[model samples]
Target: MAEVATSASSSANSSARSVSLLVVVDPVARRLDGESVRIAKDVLSAGASHTKVCLPDDPEEFARALGRRGSRRPVVIGDDSALLRAVALLHRRRELAGCALSVVPVGSALGLARSLGLPTGAVAAARAVLDGAERRLDLLVDDSDGVVLGTVGIPPVPAPVPVRAEAGSGPQGAASVRPWLRTCQSLVRTLASSRTARTAVAPGTPGPARLRVEVDGVTLVDLDQPVEGVSVTPGAAGVAVVEVRPLSVGAQASPLTASGRTVTVSGAHFRYRADAVVSGPVGTRTWVAREGAWGLTLPAE
Candidate 1:
């Protein structure tokens, strides 16, 4: 009995130490920092029981390689965008909840990866991937099937343009249009909207916008009040921290803040920055914070 127990313990220890990895090296990371990528690959290969490195040239190939990872743990060797792409892919496939994703941050756009407690250096990140703990983290998913890893900001509002009436129509002409007609018109407008505003609008410049901000079905700010900007970020325990900077008399006022499971923003044509991407002149968007929706491999505490 004693001998059998000792043999079982040894097998358990071996099982704990052994790991199989599928390393996907982002093309952008290769072009920008090939040395770091090489180092990461070497470390991961030496540490893991088995490692298969894939060099996918395009986005489709990247998706395919990740999709066919089989039983090997997928470790992304790239920047935050690459990590996000991997996460988004897994989320879309409904596999994120079951996967423990790892990353070796290797580009200029690594803010999101670093913010999530991933080591910045290639060697450190790779080693952590080999001997790390899997942590379940919160996620903010928008109604459009978009995801935000960190902060989501509604950039400075553009100057509002007045809707004009038809030549023969009166002042209420625009309002007289059927609700469905108005929606159709806005849909067309949204489709035709130029995305240049994503880069053009700076973070804190103030242009007043009449946006209705809601948290969990409760209205925080209605269309009656003009707001300077708004931001939403996932908070602890499946809540979203929201802030609305309302335009004040003569000077900017303190932002109104709230926390909840869902946040909604609606207004005239507007664009928002989610992580590093700018999206939408959307008429309305709602985001829900999903607690512990995905797992990320990080250095063990």
Candidate 2:
């Protein structure tokens, strides 16, 4: 399959004289700290003459920049978050079918990027952007129009609290912070102040909301039970896999799988984490597996 995709991409490239490229850089990527950005800029400039770089801080700006690119292929320069952002933008615009996407991991939260086998450094990643082969990938589109490319969940751990210190505090004061300490701190603060704490319906909670899930018009899991979380993922031969993890203390962990093109999830209002960001408190959401929706460049094994 990889060979076939590569051949097709080569064929497509042969007929095209010039390729327009867009480099969307997320300023916050950890590697983009001053010096790294310079190195990346130099490498990218050397590779493609028509490349245009833009830094978009938020989703709205990212989408707008992509829209302006028209037909050029987009290369995202950031970590998994930036990659996901690019995919979401393309999916929302219905342009995923036409554009090929590439990524350069540049942040601490680059787990997904590594999982996809993307290059961790700037120069190697830039070379991949220029010479890599393209392969079509599945995208999970939620009913609420949100798109994700990774696992989603509502974690059981309580959010962390922010530590307040006086001005002029030295390194000793901040030495205990972990890699995701800021995110943990924010989540803790949110949980404490929120009037209604939204938690997964697990062993300690009230109970799981009764959910009515249908896959390609067929009813699957319909029960009133405590659920830790729900996820919809892509499966073999372009199917939408659905799973529900029940709330239990160390019960066996199993994810439900389904093969279908469309999935509809409807139940009581609840918040859902899509990719890495919390998306909703929606009552009903639907997801469709858009097979071959977009193209990505993965590292050669």
TM-scores for candidates 1 onward, in order: 0.79, 0.72
Q: Mark the regions of model 1 whose C-alpha exceeds 4 Å error after superposition.
A: 1-16, 156-206
Clash number by candidate, in order: 0, 3
Tens digits of per-residue lDDT for model 2, 109-188: 77678766788887888777777788787767776677767654432223222353333343323334454766677787
Candidate 1 residue-pair clash tally? 0
Give the top-scoring candidate (TM-score).
1
What are the runs in model 2 whose C-alpha is more than 4 Å off? 1-19, 30-32, 56-61, 154-209, 247-255
Candidate 1, 142-258: lDDT as tens digits: 998888888888873343333433433443233355567668878875664544435334433347778999999999999999987899999999999999989889865999999
In the predicted model 2, the residue pairs found to clash are 143-286, 159-188, 208-226
